[model samples]
Target: MAEDHRHETHPEIVKRLKRAEGHLRSVVEMIEAGRACLDIAQQLHAVEKAIGQAKKTLIQDHLDHCLDDVVGPLARGQRRAIDEFKEITKYL
Candidate 1:
């Protein structure tokens, strides 16, 4: 497994994830209760958006901490870290 160097955990991210979890539970209930398709779709969309926001927060943290630490002399690990950081935005 890769080591996670982005150590910052914003409270807002935790709150959003908690809300997303509630939304997911509601979605399961909707499925069990045979709710309308559109309503379920809307709830799933909300979960997706929440997850995307969390990912953005994590990427920002990586850039701020891990990437900032690599700005010195060009050691091999530093070069690889810089390359990975530059490419990370594509995943977002």
Candidate 2:
């Protein structure tokens, strides 16, 4: 992870990831304790969704703020590059 830009949503993202981390730990413990598979799967799904949402927020923030800074009267090539980068992040 690199930090060339910081946004207001960053703290919120960290909070979400922390919550996901806690949930993951709980899932691990539940597995060790012989919890029902259904219960463990539900917790794992929550953690997965939490992490996915955090990633989406981070990428959207970067595109909205960081790229916006570079969008002013740039040459065509640079703009295309930025667009390409934005497109690639969609896969994340």
lDDT (Cα, tens digit) per residue for candidate 2, span 1-92: 99676789999999999999999999999999999999999999999999999999998888967677857667887779877888788888
Give lDDT per model, in order. Answer: 0.81, 0.90
Residues 1-92, candidate 1: write the lDDT tens digits.
Answer: 99744364777788889989999999999999999999999999999999888878877776766666757558787579677766777566
Stretches off by above 4 angstroms in model 2 are 1-4, 73-92
Inter-residue clash pairs, candidate 1? none
- Structure candidate 2, residue pairs in collision: none
When summed lDDT is taken over every stretch of 10 residues in candidate 2, the lowest stretch is 64-73
Task: Tell me how far the alpha carbon of residue 64 in candidate 1 is from the true structure, in angstroms, after superposition.
Answer: 1.6
Candidate of highest lDDT:
2
Residue 67 shift from truth in candidate 1, angstroms: 1.0
- Model 1, 91: alpha-carbon shift in Å? 9.1
Residue 2 CA error for candidate 1 (Å)? 12
